[model samples]
Target: MSTKIKANTDAFIKARVVKGYSQRELARHSGLSHAYVSLLERAIKSVGPSTAKKLSDLLDKELEELFRIEMQPRP
Candidate 1:
């Protein structure tokens, strides 16, 4: 089963910004859909390991560094 991952929105955004990748650009680099990237950025969706790995590799970060343990409670 694929479990949802808890991510820090600020960190995520910062990484993207530091890399100079727009959502669409990150989507291309990470092999994820642009809409999905937007959803992730908005915290509307959670990421699984596969997706996280792709993004991590693209960002050149460790897998664990891409996310946090405490997730935002659903609204």
Candidate 2:
């Protein structure tokens, strides 16, 4: 099952700023929806692993620097 990833907002923003990618551009390049990117940035939604990976790759940022990946309690 896919799990939620905790993205460090400040780090994420910094990475994006350094890469000079707007949310829409990041989403498009990452193959994610713009709204999803927005939600992640807003801390309204946790990023999925694949999405995180895509963003990491596209932004060329280290995954750990962007996200706090931890095991979660199963529902």
Best-matching candidate per TM-score: 2
- The TM-scores, one per candidate, come to 0.77, 0.82
Question: What alpha-carbon RMSD in Å does predicted model 1 have with respect to the real structure?
Answer: 3.8
Candidate 1 backbone overlaps, count:
0
Which runs of model 1 end up more than 4 angstroms from their true locations? 69-75
Q: Kindly list the per-residue Cα lDDT of model 2 for residues 1-75, writing each as its tens digit.
A: 345687889999889989999999888888778998888887778877787888888879888889986567776
Estimate candidate 2's alpha-carbon lDDT, on a 0 to 1 scale: 0.83
Off by over 4 Å in 2: 1-3, 70-75
Q: Using alpha carbons, what is the TM-score of model 1?
A: 0.77
Evaluate all candidate structures by whole-model CA lDDT and list the values in order: 0.78, 0.83
For all candidates, the clash counts are: 0, 0
